[model samples]
Each structure stands twice: as C-alpha cells, then as structure tokens.
Target: MLTYSRDEIAAYLDGVVDLEPTPDAAGLLDGVAEELHALDRRPGEVVLVALANGAALLRCFFGVLLAGGVPALVPPGTPTGRIREIADRIGARTLITTGHPADPPGRQLGPVQVETLTGVLPQRHEPGHVVILTSGTSGVASGCLHRFSSLTRNAARHARSVGLRADDTILVNLPLYFSYALVAQALAGLVTGARLVIAGPPFTPAAYWTAVREHAVTSSSVTPYMVRGLVAADWRPPPSLRMLTVGGESLDPATAGAVLDRSPGLEFYLTYGLTEAGPRVSTLAAHREPRRRLGTVGRPLDGVRVALRDPGPDGVGELLVTSDTVLRRKVGVAEGRVGDCLVGPDQIATGDLFLLDDDGYLHFRGRLSDFVVTGGTKVSLASVRRIANALPNVIASATRTYQAHDGTRFDLDLYLYEADPVVAEEVRRELRRQLVRAEWPSRIRTLSLRDLGHK
Candidate 1:
C-alpha cells in the first residue's frame, strides 16, 4: 500500500507539530483536539474547516484528524455562503469557522467557532479520508477524497525527495487550503518533524524576506507567480535558505535561471501534480541540471508511475498517474455521490498534457483543454497566455480558440488585461520575437480593469 505503518503514522498523528513559536504549539494543538473531540460526534462524519492559514487553522485541521473525523478544507476567507454550500455538498456534520457566529447555540472553542448542522446526512467514506478542493478552472470545484495515510505517505516521499530534516524550518507562505501547501508543505513538514513557519496570503517581497530571515527557513515552496514577483523585486534569499520548491504553474527556464542566479546555493525543485493524485506526481531537482533539463518535472516518486494516455504523433498526451496515493474518489462533485469522478482504482487521469522523454522525465506541455487545433496546426493557449502575461503592461491574460463565423478556419484570440495601444503594439512586437507565425494569436484584444470587473 506504501502507506505508513500504524506506529509510523502515530509518530506524526500524535507527535508534536513544530511551529514558529516552537514551545507552545504542542500544548495548544492538544487542547484544540481534546476540545474538538468533546463536541457531538459521529463515526466517519465530515467536518468543514474554514479558517485562515495559521496555527489556529492547522491546529483545527490536525484536531479533526486526531478526533477521528474527516476534514474538508476550504481557502481561508472563503465566503460564508460558499462554505455552507460546500458543507451541504459534502454533507458535512459541522462547520468550523473563524470569528463570532451570527446564530446562537454555536459553541466557541478557543479561536474557532463551531456550528453543528442539523439533519444533513454526512457523506459516507472509509475512515481517515480527507477532502481537498480542486482549482475548478475547468468546471465546478470538487472535493478530492484522499486517505489520510496516503497523504502522509505522499508527504513522507516528498520530504525525502527534498531532503527535509528535523532541523529544517519549512516556510508555508501558500494558503493551507491548497493541496500543495497542505500535503507537500505542511504535512511534509510534520512528517519530517521540521519546524514550520506559516507566513502569507498577501505575499510581498518585504514580508517574504522578513519571514525567511526571521525563521532561518531552510526550505519553502512558491508558485511561478511568486517566483516572478520575487525576481522582479530583486529578492536575495537569506544564507539560511537551502532548498526552495516551485509548483502550481509552469516555471519557464528564464524565470528559473533568474531565481538560481539570485541564490546560487539554493536547491530549487520544480514539481507537478494535481489534487487527484494526493497532489505530488514528480519533482525535478533543478539544482542538479538547472540549465540542461529545466523543462522536465523529473520522474515519478518512488512507488509512482506515469503513463501517456493516447499520445499523438508529437508524443504529447494527457498524463495518467498511477500511485497508491491517488484519491479514493471525489466528493461534492455534480453526481451527488461518491466515485462519480473516479477514472480508475489507484490511478487518475491528470487532465494535464505532457511528454514522457526517453530518459524517464516528464515535460509538461499544458492542460489537455488548453491546446487547440488552429489552421491545421496545434496551438497551445497556455503558451499564448504565458507569452502575453510576460509583457510589461499586462496585468493578466487569457486565450481562446475559436472558429471563424463562416467556418473557414480556426484561430486563436488573446486577451490582455489593462493594455493600452502602446502595450498592444509591444505585445505584438514581443509575440513576433518569441513565437512563429501559426502560433501567433489571430486577434489581440486589450481589456481594461473595468472591462474585466464587468465580466
């Protein structure tokens, strides 16, 4: 099964989760877990944790697992209405939220407020299942049900991959709701008995620098957006920083180069995964082959395998991951029952396109839906969006593949946010410099702040 043994799992589930404060974290977590267990209970019941990213939220998160209940995590500051909707969708037994509850009879447990929902039958699942929400870029967000042991196993694997140790302090600036942050960062930190520093939702260069320095963070994870932000801000990693991991978006070679140039000693690992696979598929040790193999997301972790589903002539295909840690099933999906989104047992169709090279590395092409056939040529919307978003005046960008109204030919449309005439011209100039003719967007549409707001 590759899952942790009973004693090994207990080492983490019952062990002290080291946090920034270092001393009081254990006692506080125990108190919260004890108080949480004292409440009305049901076996295999699902509990919704809608708290922000901090010790309190993590305390509650582990508290649920310790108290023998399932936890469905939502982004901190998710709207109350939305939280309730997810609760109903998942058939949760209780809602654990921050701040005072509007209704009476809600019990206050330390910093969190718990409101029990009446008559909503809790969803059925095997014991120790944890639900993490998907990004929902393609459709409605679904809760991926993963066995807690599998998640910890994945975390342990990832921790070993990154060489995490007990003396290391892992900085989790990303929100806890994200599987990358939850499993790869938070749970991985716990698995290794590493100290964790919960830092940001509103990430700034100053705040990030302060966190790294103050905590002497040895390892941390960031998205491509954060990588760009840090590079643009001329961020210099502190001497204590030893390892940095990048995921959640494609890290272009140029961006990766810039990050390495800034901190030559840092071990940067580029990773790839989805919510369906317990969130970590592979990781490239960029520090080893930073320039030569910057394009690949490395090989699958130990006990994990990757297959190309229906590869085309060019060898790109939707990536399928086979691992013991793949989600058991999806909850809160449209089907209103478990297993609606199950593609196969112990396997998941990642829905992301990739190329498996002869040397056993996976090169991420783009999302399966992000590629479009235009003018007999396959064009990548993800590539188009990446190019447009790199322009100076572009705040954000999107791409669309469409056919001419008369069905004459297919073309790509590019949308750039907050672009003026000069910016549009700059984009065209840059596109010409970076892309070939067929790959170019047929139309360049400049969208203003107000226009985007209306949408």
Candidate 2:
C-alpha cells in the first residue's frame, strides 16, 4: 500500500518548499484546483495547458487532475494554431494558458475555448486522466495517455526501488511537460513526501548550481545537453547534492568522468525509458555498480520485463517491454494533425536496439528506425551522433542516409549544429580518430542553434 495519496501531496508541501522565484506548491495547487472546479469540466475531458515553468504550472496540472479533467501539457511557446490542432485532435474543448492572447473571459479557436485562470475559490477534488506529449521532432507529436492510478503506482514502486525518502529535497530542472520530469521527478517527490525545489526559467548551469546550493537539494535530474553545458561552464556539484540523474539521451564517458571527478561523493544515475511506459523502464544506480559502463542504459525497473526480438549475430535486437505502467493507447496521426485515437496491444515494442551483457546490463546501440545501410554496411546513427556530440564545441548532431539518383550506393550525411569552422575541423579530426572508414560521414554540414531541435 502507498503511504501518500494525491490528496495528501499538497499537505506534505506545507512550508515554503519550492525554491525562490516559484510559488509555494501547496497554495498554488489549491488555487489551481479551485479554478478548475469553477470551470465545471466533465470527467475524462481533455484540457490543453500551455504554460511556462513555475508553481502555477504545477498547480494547474494537479488541479485539472483533481477536477476530473484530463490535462495535456505542452511547452509555453507552442504556436496557437498547433495548440488548437492538438486540442481538437484530443477532443479537448478547453485551452488553459498564460501568454497567448485571448478574450476577456475566453476566446474561441475552432472547437476549442481558451481561458486563463482567475481568482481561487473553495477546494474540491476529483480524479481524471493525463496526456503526455512526445518531443514531436518528426513533425507530429504523439500523445501518450495514462490514468492517475498508473502514475502513482509506478511512482511509489520507483520511490521504493530508488530509496527516495521524505527527508530528501529534490530539484526539478527539466520542463514539466516531459514525462521524465512529470513522473520520475515531480510525482516521485510527491509520493515520497520529499521537498520539491522548482528551478525557475533561464535554466543555465549557473542557475542550476545556485538552486542546488541554496536549497540544499539532495537530488536532481538532467539531460546530456545540460550535462554538456555544466561541463563547459566547469560547474561542480555541491556537497549537499547526493545524486544526479541523467536521461533523455546517452551520457558520454568524458562528461560522466568530469562530473565524478569534480564531486567524488556524488552518485550518478543513468536511466532509460520512453513516454509510453509511464516514462520509467529502467535505472542504473551509481552506488550499485562497481564502475560506470560507457554506453549501457542499466537494468529494467521493478515489475518490468525486457526481452529482445530476433537478435543479430552480435545479439543486438529490438527491445520489447511488458509492464502494467505501459500506455493503454496512443493518439493517432491524421495528415499532420495528431488525433486522440486509441490504438494498442498488451506489449510495447520500443524502437530502440539493445544488447544485454552477461552482467545483466542493457547496452543501448541506437534506434532501429535511424539505422542506415551504406555499401551493404549497417551503421547506427545514434553512435554517430554520440561520437560527434562528444567533440569539443559541438552542441548537437543529426545524421541521415542519402542514396545516389541511380540508388547504386548509400552515403551518410551528418549535420553538426552550432559548430564553427574551427569546431567543425576538430569534429572531423575526432571522427577520423573514433569511427571506421565505412562509418565516416560522406557530407558534413554545420548549422546554427535554430536549425537543430532542443533535446
């Protein structure tokens, strides 16, 4: 049985738990719940929420859930048209936001009605569903649906497995819309009765460390992009920080080594998951392992089963997962708009390729969909991207396979975003040193930050 309930989560955050710049979580949650209840939204109805990171956003999320209305969270800057398209496809009639221009009370966008929160009233509670959006880098984003019970269940199991405690203070730096931030960090903190320190906007390395030091934050989550930024800034974890969780992308050896060297007492956790599986499938606890594995994503989480399908000679194959936490169905894609349509089976085939080691660690090779065949040789785009991103001054990279007009042979095209001429030359040098001749990119192009997707 779980020790904490959603109703009691706000109570646990009685004091000034959230760090400076964000409102008190408990008060914000109550206010947002009051507003949601005033709307009189029906159970299971979808509500699109486009807000920036702060206490109000968190409150609105839980408030909608408590009001018996499904909440779909998107980034604050998502275009109004895109927001309407997502809401329409999800059958959502209400849109809640902070920045977008709306009428005095509300504005009509096609079938959706946009409204901003006003004064808070009395408290009321109800249960509803949650809709988490995919990164949508492929032009259209998919929405993964989950019940409130599924989130709390996995969160409780995760808290126990990870040794989360009520005394621990957690820092939430990632965007709340991402499943990793929502379930693994925010919800986990609520389940464990831990003090959540919400980091404010302009999320830079300096700001991250400042919050960690000021709040005595015990644990925090980060991505490879953030890791690179921290290392570039030469930022070191303070003594108060006990654990640093890395996900969203593979962590390179150099960055990991730098972090470990700077904070010898700090533990680094490398986790793996998709939005489909309640966003948490496996975790590699730093303390449990003797040494950090270079490219492995660790073992499966508790109650989750991972199996390989039709592995090659190297024992690499598609990873299939079966868990109660997996999404029941995902929204479908229509033309370019995503529609709320239920589609699924019992097991989810994660498009990622992996190889299980004798020690029971799962090593991530790359995505099966991103595999490129050139001159009859198969190459992993993930491997290429990892290698290129590790180079000095290279922010991010994307690779695609191109074939000649006659389709005689395939060539690899590598786009290195945010690299200057000097950095591009260095990248080439590193590529020659790290990759084989067949894996070398046929064409290399440098792009600005705007050209690449933010990880």
Candidate 3:
C-alpha cells in the first residue's frame, strides 16, 4: 500500500518544475487530510466530498481518504437529479463542494464549501470505506466498494507502466470521478512523486495547450471524443508531450490518425481497463500504435492478464481478464455475471465481444448479448456499427434488430432503412462489400438512446 508524500517533489516543483506559481503538494495533501480529520470530529462522524475544481477541492479529495473516511467523488457536472441520487445513496449528512448550486441549496444536502485557495486543510482518517458508483449500459448504478489500500496498490503498478519520474507532468482531462483519472493519473502521479496537471474546467483548446506548455505536461490519457473536438478546433497538442493514452472505450481510427499526425515524437497508447479491475489493466505497447485500424484497445499490463474466452471450441467469446491488480470481487450482486455483464467481476467478461486473429491481436465484435437475430440468423452488432460508421451521414450507430420487436422497450440500431435517403443504399453497399449477406439487417434503424450520452 502507498501513502503520498510531496516533500521532495514540492521542493523540485518550486525549485525547478513549475518555477513561478504552483500549489505546494505536501502542504496541500497534509492540509486536506487534516481538515477531514476535523470534519470527522463533528456530530455526524461522516462527510461526503462533492467539489468541482479548486485547490481546496483536490485537498478535500485526498483528505477524506487520509482521514480514513469514505469519500464519494460526485463526477463533476452530474445533474441535480444525480446529485440528489448520490446524496441519498451515500446517506451523507453533509455533502462538500466548492460552490453552492443554482438551486435552493438542496434540502437534505447542505451548505457548500465554496473553496478558497487559502492555506492547507488538516490531514485525518483511520481507514473505513471508499466508494465509487458506476452505471449499467441502461444507466442504473450500483455502488463499488474499495479500500484506500486497494487504490495505492493499483497506483504502484500504474507508475511502473507509465515510467513515472519527478519531471513528468501528466495532462488529466478525464473527470476525477473516473477511476482512470484517479488511479492512472492522479494517484499514480502523487504516489510516484510526479506532478499532475489538472485541466477539465472550460475544456477549451487554448486551456489544454496552456496546461501542456505551462506545466510541461509530458504524458496524458485522453478520450477520442475530446481529440475530435481539439482537431475540429484546429489544434494539435504540443510536441513536448512524451506519452499519450486513450481509454474508456475504443478510439476510432480516423481520430487516432489525426492526433498522431500532430505529435511526431509522442508515444501514443490505446489502453483498456475498468474500475472493477483496480483501474490499471492492459495497455498497448507504444510501438503497436500503428495498428490502431484493427481497433485493438491494448494488451494487458504488469500483473494484468487478458484472454478471450473460446468462441466455440475454436474462436472468440467475451474477453476474460485476471490479474494481481484485478478486483477481488464486487458487492450488491447475486448470480448476475450473466444477469449483467457489467456487474460482478473482478474478472470482467467485457460484453464488447472480440476475436483474436491467428497473430493474437484482438478485434471487437459488438456486445455479446446484442447480436441481432433475424428469423434464424445472428448478426454481430458491432460489425454492423462499424459498417454504418464507415458510411457517410452515419454519425454513430448501434444494432438492436432483436430488441426492436417490443415497442415499450425501445432499443434501436445504427442505420435506418428510412434514414438519409442516400445513406440506406450507401450503408447496404458498404456492408455487402465487407460482410456476408447473413450480416444484413432485416430492418435497418437509427440510434434512439439519446439518454445514453456519448460523442
């Protein structure tokens, strides 16, 4: 288990790294932990952190853990409805945040902290619980249980894989609530004594570049959607960046090409992992980056093993993972690994099915349960999604020909038979060229789950 100490790094940052204006890492961690200790002394004996970006906010995050108290990071910008849900789920008597919301200060969740970048908050905790809430594809959530020690162990492995050095500055664009950001970026940097350059606020192209150059951000893990936005804004990241990793989902090849084109010196990676697996899992070797077209996420990392379950006796099924950094198990479940592929796995059977070529590179075939059944034929939904995305006018796509029979259930596919007048023909043409006739949809359709947000 790792505990963060910012002394030498603090000296290095002030004496060499940031040089001008930067927060003191040691003072910040100590203060935050101390404050949480004080807060624990209050009547409730429990407090929940729900802050946006602020120096104090960051401190509060670590402080809650240091104080040995449970801290639930309300993913920044979570809706008011979600805020209420989080408060209720955690049964928090006090919810902490940097500023008050526009609403009537939320009845049951009280007075926001309204962060001031003042002196450090105190350190406190004796170890109890750590919680992270994750949702289903349909958006229902279950609380994930973790100990602070589990987070530190995961961070140790993450630092080794990322080659952490005091000189490294990692651009953290993912939300702190995202386990990827916490384990792979924030905790990985803090535990290894490296600097983290936080940057989710205005999410602007200029703000991103400013952090990159100003902090000398050497590494970052970014999403493909964010990359597309930056590309649209006519921006390329600074070449000073040494490492780049993409995660959360597969990155489309077109966007990956645009990013690699800009930074000739950057070592790009496509990593795949989840919160259940202690966050750090397999990462593609930077050298294999040229192979992105196959849409391979990456190979497993140190202590992480990723193997595809045999499809029949000879092929692919859902991916099965096992590792030292893997989750011991999950809470609030019963006989549900099949009940929901997303739940009950230290060993995640990634419902996003895939196949290993003779060479061993993994290729995605949509969700396992999502295969469309047409009369008697089964079509891989992801293959159809890929075919649809390739066709012009198809922004994004999914397949639910099997689920379409029920009217109230309302699941749909990517391309519609009646979509763009020209698109239907174009998609049919592309699918025929790439897929067997058996893969063709009996009825093509457009995406309808706008409720599930993704760019």
Better of 1 and 2 by lDDT: 1
Judging by TM-score, tell me the better candidate of 1 and 3. Answer: 1
lDDT per residue, candidate 1, 207-325, as tens digits? 89888898788998987777877888899899999999987766778888888888888999998877778878898999888486887888889879889989999999988889999
Segments in model 3 whose C-alpha atoms lie over 4 Å from true places: 1-47, 99-129, 136-141, 286-294, 310-314, 328-346, 358-360, 368-455
How much does candidate 3 score in TM-score? 0.65
Clashing pairs in 1: none
Tell me the spans in candidate 1 whose CA falls farther than 4 Å from its real position: 1-38, 100-102, 137-141, 334-341, 369-455
Clashes of each: 0, 0, 19
Spell out the clash pairs found in candidate 2: none
lDDT of 2: 0.66
lDDT, candidate 2, 111-179, per-residue tens: 223574232121212345687875331112347777767887777766766677888888887778878
Off by over 4 Å in 2: 1-7, 13-16, 19-40, 103-127, 137-141, 332-345, 370-455
**How close to the true structure is residue 231 of candidate 2, measured as C-alpha lDDT?**
86
Quote each prediction's TM-score.
Answer: 0.75, 0.73, 0.65
TM-score of model 1 vs. true structure: 0.75
Per-residue lDDT over 283-312 for candidate 3, one digit per residue giving the tens place of the 0 to 100 score: 665434564443776555666666777686
2 or 3, which is superior by lDDT? 2
